[model samples]
Structures are given as C-alpha cells and as structure tokens.
Target: MSSGNSRGRGTGRNQGTGRKQEPQKRESILEYQKYENKMIRVKFHGGREVQGVLKGHDNLMNLVLDDTVELMRDPSDLNVITEKKRNLGLVVCRGTQIIVISPVEGMKEIPNPFQQ
Candidate 1:
C-alpha cells in the first residue's frame, strides 16, 4: 500500500538552484610567467638586494639567477695589477617568500635566443 513512497528518490534536492558555478579566483598580484628569462632585481628580507638575468624557475617557483654579482664588491683586488679570474655561480631563491621582484631600469626586452 505504501510502495509509492518507497519508490520516490531525492532527485529534487538541488532543483531550485539557477546560479552558474563560480569562476576560479584570479591572482591579485601580477604573475611572474610573463617575465621569464628577463633580467630582474629581487629584494630579499633584511634589505638585501641582488641583480642578475633570470634564467629559469623550478616547479617550486624558485628563481634561477645566472651571471649574478653582489651589489658591492671590494676594489682592493683590482690594485694587484695581475691577471686574475673569477667565476660567478648560479643563485637560486624560493619564490614563496621573496620580498620583491622589480625590473631593472632602462632594461630593454631582449629576444630569447632559445626561441626560434
């Protein structure tokens, strides 16, 4: 006698909804992908600054700095007047907590040699 009640399923639970699903939230700050392989100045915590041509980034968003140099270098070594060689190594910084990433002034966008 009560077979109708048992056969009814709860298919109308969400039938009243007329709104579309919300779109994904966009990032507030500018994304870093546009400036890949471009030279940039990154300011770290404690007022420390570094400059170099950005090489690449890892999956963790760590920046790779090639041909980098310290902001300040001692001039005493230049007085030696002898042949000396110095090699600069790569610098990597995690993007999760970088204080700032600013482009160097008067820096023109250069073509990426890797791109055909």
Candidate 2:
C-alpha cells in the first residue's frame, strides 16, 4: 500500500535545475519613491494639470494626492491660465491619464494639511 500524501517529494515543476532564475524586472511609470510625501505637479492628458502633495502611489503609477488643485489654461487666451482649488482632501489619479510627474518648482517642502 502507498501513502496518499505527496509532501517533500521532488515532484514539482522546475525542480533541481541548479540554475538560478533571474528576477523579472518590473515596469514602472515613475520612480515614485523619490516623490513620496512631497508636493508634485502632475500633468495629465487633455492638457490638465494637478498640483498636490504626493501621498501615495502604486506600481502602475496611480497616485493619491493631498490638497489637490486643478490648473487649466484659458482656451481663448493661452497666456491666461486659471486655477480651481479642489477640496477633495485626498484624490486618486489614474496612472493611464498621467503624462508627467515633477516636483513643484520654487516651492519648499509642504507640510501635510491633514496632519494638522
């Protein structure tokens, strides 16, 4: 009679090859670690821009921003731009629509408003 258990046996796939498999390189849209917990400007498709503190992100580059503000340019006059403040407190932006992510220029690090 044979035991019905198959534990601790060399019966699994890719066993005993003695060759170390190379780690798969993961694709990422941005080096989000550097931008974490910092204020960043996110430019999206259709010429929309958002400025907020980068709260969090995922491998797909989907972002969670705090104290977000939406920036738009006047269609009639390209030079005339307007900003609409959003009270979302925390906003999640889809990665696919993101065009660029950059540090906010000329601004020092901002403290999290939610913490205070």
Candidate 3:
C-alpha cells in the first residue's frame, strides 16, 4: 500500500523537522544537599504529614526518604497528630502532593492562636 503523502507520515516526533528538538533542562528548587541525611518532615496537600531522613530528590520534586513514617491524625480531631500511623521505612513523596518541606528539628508545637 503506497500512500500519496510520505514526507510527513511517520511515528517519530520530529516528523516535519529535519533535526530533533533539544529537551529543556529541569532544575530543582530545593537544595537537597543542605538537607541530605537529615531528618525532615514533608506535609502533603491533604494535610497528611510524613517524617523521615532526607535521602534524595529529583528535579520534579519527588523526594526519597529513609525511615519514613506517616503521622497519624487524632481520631476525634483531624488537625492534631496523635501518633505515627505506620513505619514505611523507605518511601517516595511525590512533588505534586507535597505542600511543605521543613526540617524536623525546626518544628515546634504551639497553642492555637485563634482559640478563645
């Protein structure tokens, strides 16, 4: 079967162009080097928080954490973390789901400012 148009008919991405396009470089915003091998807490978009030792991360923001454990929220109150839910050991926190990344040592619990 011979088609009339053969120039622009291929399964390749650069079908019409003669040369292939170069992929843009992706750079990571967080300095993983500073937090490497240190305890860090990552908060997800849905208020889920996880604590672990920072291992590595990619440009897309996906982080590899060692000894990862998800913080369990109080059964009565979703705003409070009662304890650790499970020991994940090793886990990858997706960049898209992560809302905050902070050092574990820097975190402190304070009384609610709005409670009257």
Candidate 4:
C-alpha cells in the first residue's frame, strides 16, 4: 500500500517541479541595483525602522547593510520618535522582516562602493 502522507514529497509551492523557474526580470533587478551602496531606510515589522548603507542583497531580497541605525518610538508617547545609532559596520537582515526600502534624501551617492 502507498503511504498517504504527503510530507517529504517535493510538491510544495515552487518546489520539486521539473521546470526551471524563470529568472527575475531585468527591470526588477535594475530597480534595486540602483540602491546598491547607497544609504537607504528600511522599515520592518512591529514599528521598527533602520537606515543603513546598502552593501548587498540576494534573490530572496535579504539585505546586507553597513552603518546601521535603528529607530524607535517612545512607548509612553507614540508621537515621540527616538533615534538610536549603532556602528554595526555590517549586518544581514532577513528579507521577510523588511517592509519597505527607500533611498535616503540629501545624501551623496557612493559610486561602486562594493568594488574591491
């Protein structure tokens, strides 16, 4: 008799399919590419926000940032926002935790900061 359990079977979403998943469109890559090595703001779940330099990223949209600064609002006064800066130097942020990424205004661009 065949086992009824579907576990361990490679039938999950975007998995175990014979066909290769199409590569990400160039436009999407280009859009994020422009932000590389630039100072940007990242908002996350639970009202947390961070600003840092875009160091690297992956297909999963995970990010590596340098000079990270975390922002938070005062729990007693929601209207009051506080800034806590830390010299993280480098950090890898999970893609699932990211809410949005926006370019920082009035900051000079660092051309090809990733070049060795």
| Leading candidate by lDDT | 3
Clashes of 3: 0
The TM-score leader among the candidates is 3
Give the clash count for model 4: 0
**True-vs-predicted CA distance for residue 31, candidate 4, Å:** 1.5
Pairs in clash, predicted candidate 3: none
Number of the candidate with higher lDDT, 1 or 2: 2
User: How much does each candidate deviate from the true structure in C-alpha RMSD?
Assistant: 13.0, 11.4, 5.0, 11.5
User: Per-candidate TM vs. native?
Assistant: 0.47, 0.62, 0.72, 0.60
| Candidate 2 lDDT tens digits, 12-113 | 565688665577788785578887888899888878778899988888878999998877688786544566454556899999999988899565646669
The TM-score of candidate 4 is 0.60
| Over 4 Å off, model 2 | 1-29, 78-80, 83-86, 106-116
lDDT of each: 0.65, 0.79, 0.88, 0.77
lDDT of 3 by residue, 22-54 (tens): 897877767888999999999998789999999
Pairs of colliding residues, candidate 4 = none
- The full ranking of all candidates by TM-score, starting with the best, is 3, 2, 4, 1
Looking at model 1, report the run of 10 residues with the lowest lDDT sum: 78-87
Task: Pick the winner on lDDT between candidates 2 and 4.
Answer: 2
Model 1, residue pairs in steric clash: none
lDDT of 2: 0.79
> What are the runs in model 1 whose C-alpha is more than 4 Å off?
1-29, 58-61, 73-88, 107-116
